[model samples]
Target: MTIGGHLEELYGLPAFTFPGPGETPRELPEPDAVAWRITADSYDAEEQWTEAFARFCSAVDTTRVRALAVGAWEDAYDRGPGDIIEALVTARDRLPGLRSLFLGDMHSEECEISWINQTDVTPLLSAYPALEEFGVRGGQGLRFPALRHDALRTLIVETGGLPVEVVRGIGASELPALENLDLWLGTSWYGADSEAADLEPVLSGARLPRLRYLALRNSEIQDEIAAAVASAPVVARLEVLDLSMGTLGDDGAAALLGGQPLTHLRKLDLHHNYLSEPLLRRLRETLGSAGVELDLDRDDADWDEDDDGTVHRYVAVGE
Candidate 1:
């Protein structure tokens, strides 16, 4: 399944889209209570995001705006968000109350997840130091560097293929207050280039002390990820551990059941995987009794085309 729609709500605030060129924005009870969205009408629209952003800033009280969603820019499939990022950074003082920001919220219709060209978004983190939640989509031309930040509590990066440098950057970065982290490590066929070793720092929890939830979804190497995560020091502290939308099989599930006693975890999500029925039954029988909320749904129905011990699996989202 593809990303079908825009976010209904973000940071506990309803998303309010600022109208495109020649359109009118609706009246809001409080600008601060809504997540203001600034996006162009289309990918190749003559009216670019710069104009839309300028209009939003002029029409709304920026200081009171607490959340922002920057959707598809003009030619987002080909262009990086350098100019848009600069604009947001330049206007940082005007958005002092902005606590949540989502960059590149385009669905596959406008730009496929593997096609949106992104740039180094590290500047946003440094500029919006007070931001509590940050979400980014797409991975093509994406770049993230390791840095220190104290106030960020949630970080989400969704992509059809997440590169290694970005993953390693996050693993090495210092995020003391980060409680939730989600990384969609899509298939390598589209440029996902990280191994389980790349996740070592994050699994150690050395840099992210307050991390309580960790989701490593959509990977060609889901079993390796599961094996690494099974005994990782960070798993002991996480309330929710998600290894969904990937190629998980009985091998990975076995590692999870063997390495650590997951009774302490509140939830374990393994949806959209390639696990067999026996393992699924075993999981339900075992975790069900332990009160661990397990999600083993949508285990692909056609997972066994070969009996030669060679497995064929696919990730949920990839270009």
Candidate 2:
């Protein structure tokens, strides 16, 4: 059976309850567990899916649900962006216990520009005050909502069209307790001259005071910008840094690695850039001397590998 099928089976089980003011609901059976997958090929299907989702949200004890995954088909063209955003916002508000939210195949017609302009993401963010990790995939032009969650720690944006400014706007203060940040920009960002301009504002602000892990993937950044990002005051306390697919050449990579004030950093990722053998050697030597673990992904392999893949392999730089 498919993953969706298995999730559906999980949702069909009895409701899971907890100790609260009212009766604790039991967990759903297997068949109904995958309520997040709404394949709206036809009007009837769309209506039925929405209705089922609403009912599930209202009946299921959200405190028992831990993760939420929203998937959209690449060819499903019937639904609009507003429909998906509305549905997602509804579910987010209803599921207060949600700790992780994954937005998959986000390029569907349901995630168009108009949908973003119309959707009020602030309320949805406000609802999930306990959210810990958020992942957005396959969409562009998504604005950041002013998040006030003390529990938020990880924010991952994986899209080709997401702007740099949006990523930088997520300051440490915005997530006072934030620790990990993962950003994957699209190929379109490579042509921009001021790619790192957006990040300056957040770096100057009191954002991410306690940030430890940071990842910047698939962005077209120059040496100067990379240096600036590395030298940013807020990042001085970082323990992990990932710059996969950032197009940082030897000079840029060297600048960033050499200029970084991250004394406690333990892990560093530099993948899919124009690093020659000499530059790679230099990076290894420099970071090794600093006692940091380097995770390097040369251009020899495909970058879209799974967790078990070799996209990120640890290399000891120093003795």
Clashing pairs in 1: none
Tens-place lDDT per residue, model 2, 217-317, is: 55555354577777787567677777765556677777776775554678777765667788788777877668888767664423345677734322111
lDDT of 2 at 160: 47
* Candidate 1, 44-140: lDDT as tens digits: 5868798789988888889999999999998887889999999999999999999999999887788888888899999999999999999999999
- Candidate 2 root-mean-square deviation in Å: 9.5
- lDDT: which candidate is best? 1
Superposition TM-score, candidate 2 onto the true structure = 0.68
Task: Please provide TM-scores, in order, for all candidate models, with all chains considered together.
Answer: 0.96, 0.68
